[model samples]
Target: MPVDFTHPWVGRTVIYTAAHPNARPEQGIVTSVNVEARIVFVRYGAGTTSKATSVDERLQFLDGSDLILWK
Candidate 1:
């Protein structure tokens, strides 16, 4: 499914779970969104660590899916 760039979830904090079984989860703030491209960029590890990072991820809206919005 395609992502909605204007969704309220954009610019919020979220946790991302990789589709791979062994991948570790990440927490970050949503930086940008591209509905047409189905991509979301997140800026993670801010204030929690000295080094912060941003990651580009594919949007997945399916229930019980890999990536999800963090409450």
Candidate 2:
């Protein structure tokens, strides 16, 4: 399913499920949304090792097939 870029998804919590088993389930808050690019930035996981860890990821809505939004 295509992502509704106009919808206010920012600040909402979401889960990302990948097709690969190695890709662990990611739970995070929607940090940013790029409507033009159809990509949502999510900040997930805790930085246990350092404060400068880059945990934020850019997720593309692939027909709404890989993302699950928490109501």
Candidate 3:
């Protein structure tokens, strides 16, 4: 299914499970939405090592089924 970029995803929490089963899942909050680019930026990390990644690349636009969005 195509992603619905029209939704206000910012501030929503999302779980990102890496493609590799051995990798731990990361929980993050949506930081930004770029509908034109079809990219969602997420901020996630532990302690002082905060980081961000484009959801489209990290989750493959949901094609990998690695993202669990929480309302």
Number of the top TM-score candidate: 3
lDDT of 1 at 22: 93
Clashing pairs in 2: 1-63, 1-64
- What are the Cα lDDT values of the candidates? 0.51, 0.50, 0.56
Residue 17, candidate 3: Cα error in Å is 1.0
User: Candidate 2, which segments miss by more than 4 Å at Cα?
Assistant: 1-7, 47-71
What is candidate 2's lDDT per residue for 1-71, written digit by digit as tens? 34443567666666665667688766666665555444666667662321111223334343443443342
What is the descending lDDT order?
A: 3, 1, 2
Measured against the true structure, the TM-scores of the candidates, in listed sequence, are 0.47, 0.51, 0.54
Candidate 2 yields a Cα-based lDDT of: 0.50
Q: Please provide the root mean square deviation of candidate 3 (C-alpha atoms, Å).
A: 7.4
Question: TM-score for model 2?
Answer: 0.51
Where does candidate 1 have its weakest 10-residue lDDT segment?
Answer: 47-56
* TM-score ranking, high to low: 3, 2, 1
The sequence of per-residue lDDT tens digits that candidate 1 reaches over residues 1-71 is 45455766566666666679898766666655544444565666664322122233533332324443432
